[model samples]
Target: MRQLVRAAHIGPSLAVVALATLLAIADGLPAQRVLLVALAVLAGQLSVGWSNDLLDEARDRAVGRSDKPLASDAVARRTVLVACVLAVVAVVALSFACGWAAGAVHLAAVASAWGYNLGVKSTVWSWAPYAFSFGGLVVFVSLADSPPQWPPWWLPVVGALLGVAAHLLNVLPDLDDDERTGVRGLPHRLGARLIPRVAAAVLLAATLLLALGAGIGHPASLVGLAVVVVLTAAVLLGRGRVPFVAAVLIALTDVVLLLAAT
Candidate 1:
């Protein structure tokens, strides 16, 4: 069970689910609806994470990725495959329970992620899925409201920029392993040294967008922007895992400020 959980990429899956929960709270969704949204997001993320491991089994094994349960032979491939199938079914049902509009938007985000895991991760368009998925997430939540309206245009753009920053940061550590396995995604092509700089810049843009969207005149907006600038500076200058950690802090700051402003 533990191995299976790990193979599902529990950390990232839980992180996404947590974000969904926060968004649900921020959107003032009812208790039942918030539960449904959490479940749907959880299922969708599990499917994405599991399918990613399954698809990359060969590449992960080739690169000696013992951290990956499937690649490390800690769990049976068939087991994870079945789990992924179940998650897909659950996601579909739960998403629609939220409403047609929200369901469609959420499913699109999940499909974009699946697209990434399928093959786009190896292409220059690797960043595209992240952009679509994260932006779609915000829209999905907004559509869940009774009126089913779109979020402010800038919110989606902020989400997209954050998504891109996430992708660049995520790919940084695996550049060598990915290159060895012939996975030459955009970040890999950019090489390691440049990725942190790009990620910092992307994150900075996202921060600026959020601040502007929240109204620069707001004290919270100014404070949030200043904090993000400091964090992004750390992302650019910090070494080892420091940059990744700082980026996560920046993301959290952005989300909190977004909720407060909205």
Candidate 2:
């Protein structure tokens, strides 16, 4: 059960939910709408996680990753199926509670994630999943109130860069395993030596944009930029595990930005 839970990557999903909440709050979403948006975002993430486990079960087992719930048989296939169904239902319910526009964003996110897990993850354009997933999230937060607007126009651009970094970093540790399993996506194509550099470059671009976004006036935006700069420097200096730490700092910075914006 522990392995299964970890395989679900629930913690990361929660982080994504928290990030969505920050974006929503920053955009001035009402309390009720914020709650609904959080639920929708979490549900969408759960759907993605569950679907990934299901689709990767064969590969995971082949790699001897018996720690995974599905791989270890700690949880029944039917259980995962039920979970996926419930997650989708939750998304629908929250979407309805939030509004059609919000619901559309959730559905789009779910669709994109599902697409990636099913087959897109093996393609050269695997980064599309991260881009679409984060993009949909930004759109959802942007549309939280009425017409949306909190994040500057450049937010999504920075977000795309962040998405690329996420993809590269995420695949770093799994490169060998992924290659052995024939999951030679974009990250694999980049090769090991270049992947970290790519990640650094993406993080740098995101920080620059974030700084530029804040320079016009919103000082709070600098918080995230600062975190990114420090974290990126750490990673480039051979502190490989620093990305996870940087992720936490980034999340905190986002929260601070939201509070300042509001």
Candidate 3:
């Protein structure tokens, strides 16, 4: 069970779910609706994670990536496959439970991520999935509202920027392994040395959008921008998990400010 859980990429899965939950709350969703959004996002994320592991199983094994449960044979591939299928079903039902608009947006996001897993991750267009998925997440939350309205344009822009940054950062740790297995995404083409700088720049751009889009003159917006700058610096300068942790913090801060602005 633990191995199966590991195979699901639990950390990233939970982070995506948490972002959905926060967006729901920021949108002033009722508790029940918020829970529905969280469940739908969770199911979608689980499916994405599981499928990614399943698809990459051979590559992982080739690279001797023991950290991957499928690569290490810690869990049966069939088990993970079955779980992924279940998650897909649950995501579909739960997302529609929120409403047609919300469901469609959520499903589209899931599909984009699945596209990445299937083969897009190896192409220059790898970043497209993350941009669409993350931007669609913002739209999904808004459409989940009773009236099903769209969010302010800046919100989805910020989300897309963050998504791009996420893609770059995510690939940094696996660049070598991916290269060994013939994977060459946009980040891979950018090379390791430049990816971090690009990621930091992307993150900073999101922060700027949040500040200016939210309300440039607002004292809180200025404070939030300052904090985000500090966090972005940490992402560039920090070692090990520090950069990732700081990136997450920067995201949370931006979301909070965005919510407040809205």
Off-target runs (Cα >4 Å) in candidate 3 are: 230-252
- lDDT per residue for candidate 1 within 159-192, as digits (tens), equals 7887888798788778888888888888998887
Model 1: ten consecutive residues of lowest lDDT = 253-262
User: Per-residue lDDT of 1-262 in model 2, one digit per residue for the tens?
Assistant: 5654565679778878888887787777889878878888888888888888888999988897766788878888888878888888898888656667767876887798788899887999899978877767777777667654445676766666667777776777788888889998998999876777677766676666666665735555665666666766665665555645555355345435433443
lDDT ranking, high to low: 3, 1, 2
Q: lDDT for every model? A: 0.87, 0.73, 0.89
TM-score of each: 0.95, 0.85, 0.92
Candidate 3's error at 152, in angstroms?
Answer: 0.8
Better of 2 and 3 by lDDT: 3
From the highest TM-score down, the ranking of the candidates is: 1, 3, 2
Best by TM-score: 1
Model 3, position 139: C-alpha lDDT score: 93
lDDT (C-alpha) at residue 213 in model 2: 64
62, model 1: CA deviation in Å? 1.2
lDDT of 1 at 6: 93
Cα misplacement distance, residue 258 of candidate 3 (Å): 3.5
Off by over 4 Å in 1: 236-244
